[model samples]
Target: MVKEPAVTLHLTRIGPSWMDPITNFLENGKLPDDEKEDKALRREAAKYAIIQGQLFKKGLSHPLLKCLHPDQTDYVLREVHEGCCGHHIGGRALVITRFSISEVVVSDNGTQFTNKKFTEFLTGLGIKQKFSSVEHPQTNGQVEAANKVVLLGLKKRLAKKKGAWADELASVL
Candidate 1:
C-alpha cells in the first residue's frame, strides 16, 4: 500500500477565549462602587495575562479602525508589514487589499493604486500590491475570511458597547 503525503496546517489564535469572564465583568449588574472597581481590576488583569502570553506570536493581526481613511489604511499596512516582514521588506509578500478609492484609483483606461507616495512606500519595502476586483470579493477570499474572524471577534467583544470596539481591539486581536 502507498502512503499518502502528510498535510500540514498552521493556525493562530489571535485572542483569548476568556469571553465569558470578560462579558460577565463588563455586564455585571449595577454593583457597588468598590465591587465594580474590584471586578474591573480583575478583568484588566486577566486581559493583561492573556496579552502577555500571546505577545509576538506569528499571526496576521490588525486593529479595528473607526474609518478607512488613507492615513488609517497606510498605518494598518505599515503595522502589518513591520510585524510580519520585519527587516526583510522587498518582495517578501504580495499584499491584496479591497478596491477602495483610498487604496486603488479606478479610471476608464485602467485601474491603478491611489498615488505615488503609497506606491513608493510599498516599493521601498519591496512589497507587491494587488487589488481585489471591484465586485468580486472572492479574489481575496483568504484575507476576507481572516477579516471576518477579526470582525466577528470585535463584534462579540464590543457587544452593546459598539463604540468601544476600537478600545477593545487590542484585546480582541
Candidate 2:
C-alpha cells in the first residue's frame, strides 16, 4: 500500500481591515487602550452598523453602504472599471493611461489642478495652464456643446435605467 501525505489548510486574514477596530467595538465592546483613539473609534463606530454580521457605513443618498476590506477594494474597483457592464474609461487608471503631454491644458480653477506639485509638473514640462473663464462666451459655449453631446448620448443609451449611466459613460464618450 502507498502512503499519501496529508495537506492542512488554514484560513487567515490577509491584513487587518480599516473596519476591524469599528467592528470589534460594535460587536464585542472592545476599544483601544489610548484615550483619544478609543473616543475617536466610538465616534466613528456610531456611523456604522453590523447587519447580518457585515459592516455597513451610513450614507447620505442611501441609508447604508456596505464597507469592503482594503484587499477587496481593488477587486471591486476593477470589476466596476472593466467588468461586463463597465466600459473601463473611469477611475485612477483613466488618469494614468489616457493622459498625454500637451502644450496648453485647459481646466477649471480647481485646487487640485492649481496645487504646487501639479504646477511644478506643468512648469517642468513647459505646459501652459489655461483656466476656463466663466466670463468667456466662446470657451463656455464650446464646453456646453461638448457636454450636450455627452448628455444626449447618455440619454439615448439609458432611457429609463438612469442608474446604469455611470457604466455606459465610457461607451458614450
Candidate 3:
C-alpha cells in the first residue's frame, strides 16, 4: 500500500467569535450599547464569509480547482461573495461527484440557492437542479447537516457572533 501524506493543519489567521454582545442582543432582546462597536464586530464576522470564498476562488491551487466542476470554477467567488448583506452568508458548494453531475438547487432564498450566476453556471453545464422546500430544512438533509457543522465552526471561531446559518449543503448522490 502506498503511504498517504500526513494531513496538514491550517490556522485561519482569522479569528472566530460566536457568542458576542450582538448575538445576545439579537437573541435576548438587548440592544447593542455602542453602535460603532456593534457594526465593527459585525463587519469582522462578515470578513470570514468573504475570506472563505476568496480562499476557494483566488487562493486555490490548480489541483484543488480541478476537484470542482468546470462550471464552478468561478462559483466560489461568485456565489459566496455576490450577494447583499443579510443575504451574503450562504453555504459552500459540495462537488458530490466527478464528470459533470447535476448542480445543487436549494429552495431557500439565500446566496447559495438564489444567485443568478450560480444558477446560470449549473444550467450552462446541462445539469438539472432541484430544491428543498423553503423554511423547512429537512427537505435538504445534506444542507441541514452541513449548516450545523459550519455554524458550529463559525461559532467557535467568532467566539462573539456571526450573522446567520445559510446553506451548508452536501449530497451522497
Candidate 4:
C-alpha cells in the first residue's frame, strides 16, 4: 500500500483590495506609515468587525453589511444590478438606497421630473423640489458646464467609436 501526502491550497490577494487596510488593522493591528492615514484608518476601522474571519460594517440604521474584496465586488454588483434578484434599478434608486434623501432636490423641467407620482412622492417626504428657469438654462450653468466638459472628453476619446462612451465614462471622470 502507498500513502500519499495531503495537499493544502493557499490563496493570496493578487492586487490591493479595498478591504486590505481595514482587515489588516482588525486582524493583525497593522497600520500605514503616514500619520494622517493611520489616524483615518483607525477611525474607519472602529466601525468594522471581524467575525469568523469575515469583515462586516456596522451600519447605524441598517444591518451588518458583509465587506467583500475588490475581486468579489463585480459578482455582487452584477447580482444586485442585473442578476436574477435585480430589478434593473436606475441612478435615482441607487442614490436613494445608498444615501439618505436630501431636504431639497434640484432638477430640470423635464417630463420625468415633472411627473405626478414623483412630485407627490417628494411632497409626501416634505422635500422641496426646485427647477431651473427654462428661459435661462444658465440658472443651472455649473451643472451644464460640467456636463459639457464630460461630453467633450467622451467625444475626443470616442472619436470614431461612439458606442464605447458608456464604458469609458469612469476613466474620463
Whole-model Cα lDDT of every candidate shown, in order = 0.44, 0.73, 0.46, 0.74
Local error of candidate 3 at 83, Å?
Answer: 57
Each candidate structure's TM-score, on Cα atoms with residue i matched to residue i, is 0.18, 0.42, 0.24, 0.41
List pairs with backbone clashes in candidate 4: none
Worst 10 residues of 4 by lDDT: 2-11
Assess the local accuracy of residue 151 in candidate 3 as a C-alpha lDDT between 0 and 100. Answer: 51
- Tens digits of per-residue lDDT, candidate 3, 1-173, equal 74752322244342333434434443445545698876776654333222222222223333322123333335444544663333543344333232455355444445655566556555766766666666676656767676567657755655554433222112101
Flag clash pairs in model 1: 90-126, 91-126
- Deviation (Å) of 40 in candidate 1: 44
Badly placed stretches (over 4 Å) of model 4 are 1-14, 86-173
**Per-residue lDDT of candidate 2, residues 1-173 (tens digit):** 64752222233665887899999999999999999999999999999999988799987776688888787777667666666537745568767766686798676555655677667666777999878896876886676665567558756656645554344433333
Highest-TM-score candidate: 2
lDDT of 3: 0.46
Mind giving the per-residue lDDT tens digits that candidate 4 earns over 53-103? 989999899899987777767766776667765777688877768877569
- Candidate No. with top lDDT: 4
Candidate 1 Cα lDDT to native: 0.44
What's the distance in Å from true for residue 53, model 3? 58
